[model samples]
Target: MMLAILIICSQITIPLPGVPLTLQTFAIGMIATMLPLRDCLLIIFTYLLIGSVGLPVFANFAGGLPILLSPLGGYLIGFLIYGLITSGILGLTSRSSLTICLANFLGAASQLIIGGLWLIPANHLTLSQAMTIGVIPFIIPGILKLFLVVIVAQRLLKARLLAR
Candidate 1:
């Protein structure tokens, strides 16, 4: 179910250079908020594995090692790390709004940071160029998604859908 959700989210893309903006962050947040770290990692790994094997599970219906190694590759790789950090934080600490907010922020930052760094090498871009396209543009959207995830996750947790 989560795997399907990730794939579905990937298709809700607004095409952009380097990487398309998608609802992938939304799905990633949901997965991070709702699942245990171990389970979350397993799910993210499976999602990446499928995409890497050319299942068209990535954003813009893209898949394969080429895509995995492209300028957008860091974000793809960052997803797993994002899952690890966010889910691990939630697993080990209180699930208060504040805690969730911090975890999400840190995890999201990790994605942008890693992705930005990857762009420098992959695209042979200067740091400023990578920051311009990779990190700066996504900050506000990432914050919005963070709040949405916190609200939805709390509600879902209260509803006991898989139980936190």
Candidate 2:
């Protein structure tokens, strides 16, 4: 189910020059928030592995080693970092609203930063150019996505409590 969500999220994209905007980070944050660190890692890695094996699972239904090694690939790597940090935080500490928001924000920021940095060399872009195209464009949207992830995570937790 989570894997399906990830794939679906990837398909929803707004094209940009360097990196297209997608809800992948939002889905990843939710997965990390809902699952243990290891499980979250497994899910993220599985998604990447499937994409690496030439599945049309990435944004715009495109996936291959070329996509993984493309300029936008750092965001994919950031997804792994995102799962680790976000899931590790939720696992190591209390699962409160504050923690959830903080962890998700950190994960999102890390992803954007890594992706922006990757653009510098991969696309022969300067730091300013990378920030302009890669990082700055996503800041506001990332925040919105972070809030959405938090809300969904809280609701899921509440539903689970109610179920129990």
Candidate 3:
């Protein structure tokens, strides 16, 4: 149920090119913290596959090969990394709110870093330019999403889904 919701949430976008803010990363982090690592990775991979096959499962209500080849591709790739870190962290720790929050925070940071690094090189953005356009506007939202992911993860964990 949660997996289905997350995948659909991933496709919701805010209509920005290369920067359509979506809950996919948050969902990934939350799922990672709640599910076992292998299941998390599989679900994330499947989500990506669904988008890659020309489905309108990406930003701007757009998908297909073109969107994948666009500038946002790097961030799309980074989603997988997001799952690995957050879920891996959750897997390593005993279930707790703080642990889940920390894992989501780190996962969010990793996603931001991955996006910034990829954007700089792909778009020929200098550090200052990239920081200005990519990282700065996102910090607050990212923090909020981190908090939300943590809350959701803890809720799922409390429901005894962590061991499933």
Candidate 4:
């Protein structure tokens, strides 16, 4: 069910220069908060596999190795990184709203860092340029999403609709 939500969220995209703004991070945050570490990781890996095999499971209905090889690929790979890191944090600490918020934000930061570095080579951009186009533009929106995820996850956890 969460994997399906993630796939649907990936399609909800707003295209930018280097990367598209999608609900992927938000969904990832929720998944990390609600699911076990191993399960979250598996879902992410499966999502990537489905996208890689030309399933149109990516933003703007794009898929296949070419899309995965694009500059935006890092962001896609970043999803897995985000999932693992957030899941690890959630596993090690309390599943309080504060902890969830912190873990999700950290995961977002990891995504930006990895994506920014990958952009340098894939887009033939300088480090500063990559940060400018890839990371900076997304910070505010990412924070908003993190906030939303924290709130929603907390509610779901309280309601017993989601696993801690």
Cα lDDT of all candidates, in order? Answer: 0.89, 0.91, 0.76, 0.89
Per-model TM-score on C-alpha atoms: 0.95, 0.98, 0.87, 0.95
The residue-by-residue lDDT of candidate 3 on 68-163, one tens digit each, is 666677777777888888889878887688888777777777777777777787788998877677777778888888888777766766677656
lDDT of 2 by residue, 73-119 (tens): 99898899998899998999988889999999998899889989999
Candidate 2 vs candidate 3: the TM-score winner is 2
Candidate 4, residues 1-95, lDDT tens digits: the string is: 99999989988988886688999888888888899899999999898898999998888888898988998889889988898889999999998
| Candidate 4 Cα lDDT to native | 0.89
Model 2: CA > 4 A from native: none
- When sorted by TM-score, best at the front, the candidate numbers are 2, 4, 1, 3
Clashing pairs in 3: none
Model 4 bad stretches (over 4 Å): 161-164
Higher-scoring candidate on lDDT, 2 or 4: 2
